[model samples]
Target chain A: MKAIVPIKRVVDPYAKVKPTADGAGLDSGGAKFEINPFDEIAVEEAVRQKEAGRFTEVVVVSVGKGECEEQLRKALAIGADRAVLLETQEPLDSPAVAKVLSEFVAAEAPHVVLMGKQATDDDNNQAGQMLAAILDWPQATFAAKTDFAADKATVVRETDSGEETLELPYPCLVTTDLRLNEPRYIALPGIIKARSKPLEKRPLASVPAPKSSVVSFAPAPARPPGRKVGSVAELAQAIKDRGVF
Target chain B: MSLLVICFDPSELSQVAGFGASFGTYDVLLLTGEAGNAGASKIHVANLVEVPPADNIGKSVASVAANYTHVAAVSSMRAKDLMARVAGINQSAMITDVVKVFSETEFERPMVAGSVLARVKAESTPIVMTFRPAGFDKTVPGPNGSVESISISDTGRVKRVSTSARQGGRPDLSQAKFVVSGGRPLKDAATFEQVIGGFADKFGAAVGATRAAVDSGIAPNDLQVGQTGKVVAPDLYIAAGISGSTQHMAGIKDSKLIVAINKDGDAPIFDQADLGIVGDLYEVLPELEKALS
Candidate 1:
């Protein structure tokens, strides 16, 4: 089985995001950039399938500017067999990203596609599910555990209360939760070896684009800091007192 | 106004998609937060009514049971409310988190900490189902839109009680610009404070810790930066000793510039770093601090 793990290049989480000049977007001046954290877990899950000997190849894919090729290469270092760069210099919406990813997925026809529950930048976790809709397949999101076998995968998603399990045939989409597994780091020697691994770059023109228009781009409103009680008991009491759990 | 909406179990797993798929048809309204932030389509409705859990249908029915066009909500945790709405009753309604309501059909929702997915396909035309949180294509707005509140509340159940709120401290280390994050490489809590405190003070940045560093029982979860903890989008993110697991990556994906300082140059953090120093963080930090000074 082959896998495609979608990733994003967003402002590093450690950077302080000030409101953009118009109070609509995040200020990006002199901020750090990194792969969406959830994407990292997706990449790890795909790699684990290979290590478990369940699959043969894993490809980490990203859609962004030319710089994303470097990000793709980093995924390669982590054990992804190959990488695809959907070259787009400007930031893209979920539909746009899904469109290009669907085009690539159709061409590749990988048995499974894995993605982070949501990208950290926008916190919109629908890209994987949206791509699944475009592809017309089953989707298991926020998966805590995924067991892949011959042409089929059984996944368990951890819920706030407990868990939900689903058994679906292959060619499905799965978005992973943070607790899925502690993603392993690539060794120094592995990094040197990864330099020799294969990396593929594709342009936006090469694939069809979504028939959509971005009406605006803005940062999410600042959540006035949530209050913090002394302890969980206090937190619980506060929740009770407010009657707004 | 030309609009068609659905309500479903706000806590059902399919809420997001059901809402997303139906969003293009008309003006979409999502109910969220205290639940998930449900209706966030770029071109949809946004009237987050402060209601009780799974009481939307009950409230909507009791308030406007006569205006029975359609109502949509979930049937997972709020199964009782859905029953009351479809039970052919009017005046007597219980408060519910009704996601959407069109006609007869209903939807349900299931959510983890924050991710929302809903299950739709309850009935036919005049569909009433709840809009699942994060269910639709949200980053992209549809067309020009506006918000109009339909004050459909009369049989209010819960009354406003006294509120006790506290002022929060700084946004954690992940949210800090010049974060001084520590990993297992820091031997103990005391050593950690020695290094992290100076860095935090020097740069006026917040302090953060890796899971490994936190497990030493030194720091708290508030300072832990990883997948399960706070997601930080800082200006300059630094990895002192963190190996950069995807779990840890959850907290720092939005940083602008990442600087990795570790004994292993091959750590996953380096891949995300703009500048990776290939030396011991113990040796590298003070030297870098001296240079910054």
Candidate 2:
């Protein structure tokens, strides 16, 4: 069995992202980029599954400009057998990205496609589900725990209500949540080994262009500064004064 | 001319109807399993795509959405999952967690963990969206809307094997009026259940936890309240032992009134709390609970 993990490059979660002066998108200049935290978990899950003998290969894929190769290399270093980059400089929306992934999935027919629940940059949280829709395949989003059978995978998802477990047939898609697993760090030896691993690059022109466009962007509203109360009694009194209780 | 509001759970109809109401002078179509009373203009009872396998739900919705100018639903995990796929099938411009609706074509939503707001304009014909229920006013049940039964074919692919919900009497964290959240200081699951859970029960508040606490296994993943977890905006929020990381603060920033109790006076949560009590939670929590009781 083979697992395909789709990874994304996003502004580091710890860094502050500022809107561009033109208000069209984020300011990319001098900003640090890293593998999306959730996608790292996806890669880690695939690697763990491979180590457990559930998979013979774990292939990591990314869609973006040339800079994305750095992220794919990091995935390779993290134990992915190979890396694929669909080199596209143009920004693609979630639907367009899903379309390209569906095409790839149809051609590759991996046993399972794993990816993050959402990217921190766009925060769309749609790609994996969209991919499932395009393929008419089963999807389990926000997976916290997973178990595999001969031809089925049981996933426990973290939802607004509670944990929901679902059994899906193979050749499905699963999106990883933050709690899925702690991603393992790459050591110096792994980094050196990744240098010799296969990294395939495909032209973006092979995929469909994005249908939706971002017209503008702006900063969020700021909350008012709050003052500290002296004691719990004062806090209760303030709540009473404000008629909140 | 018409707005289709897909209803997965009957209980969420009012919220979905409320979101649909934002499109003034539009018809509301409730697509659900069992046809019940709603405030919408019309109701469609469909059974073929009633449960999980979000793909089937998306297809069912897409079939009806083709006739409407706008499509909306309550931004629950289920709805977002299904509608996102519907958006992909229709190739429509879609947005989720929309906080405000300016019109049928324009809306506002938070981005980058609520630090930036983006006003979006949907150029597509049937603009698809999922509105955060907390962001909208609850819709009052008006004259019983018209009901129509629609047939749907099952795309049997995904199956729900089992569900293990947290056995708790507390209200759901996202929809609770009051939320009592804990942080890393809770130490262990036992302490978290004893202190945080105990206090939450006393106040009839839902239990929430910081990412740190959840990561430490002091709380379950669903109880995590942060940018990466559940975004909650309860009327009253109490923070115990939390130092309020930016991501955590982002989730609860919309809370009507915030009360923070922490040993560290300089905790970032204090800066956002409407009332801050600098003290050890071990002592303060029990004392507060005693006083309230």
The candidate that achieves the highest DockQ relative to the unseen native structure: 2
Candidate 1 residue B58 Cα shift, in angstroms, is 26
Q: Chain B of model 1: TM-score?
A: 0.47
Off by over 4 Å in 2: B25-37, B47-50
- Tens-place lDDT per residue, model 2, A170-223, is 888899998889999787787777899999999877556555566678877666
TM-score of 1: 0.49
lDDT of 1 by residue, B1-293 (tens): 12333332233323344444453333333333222333333222233454332222344533332334443333222232232333223211111222333323333322212122122232223223333232233233333244443443323222222222211333334225557687888888788878876666676777788877765656543466764444455666667888877557545654555667778766877666555666777776776665554
Predictions: Cα RMSD each: 16.5, 2.2
Q: B158 in model 2: Cα distance from truth in Å? A: 2.0
Q: How well is candidate 1 docked (DockQ)?
A: 0.02
Worst 10 residues of 2 chain A by lDDT: A206-215
- Each model's lDDT comes to 0.55, 0.81
CAPRI-wise, candidate 2 is medium
Q: Give the number of colliding residue pairs in candidate 2.
A: 1
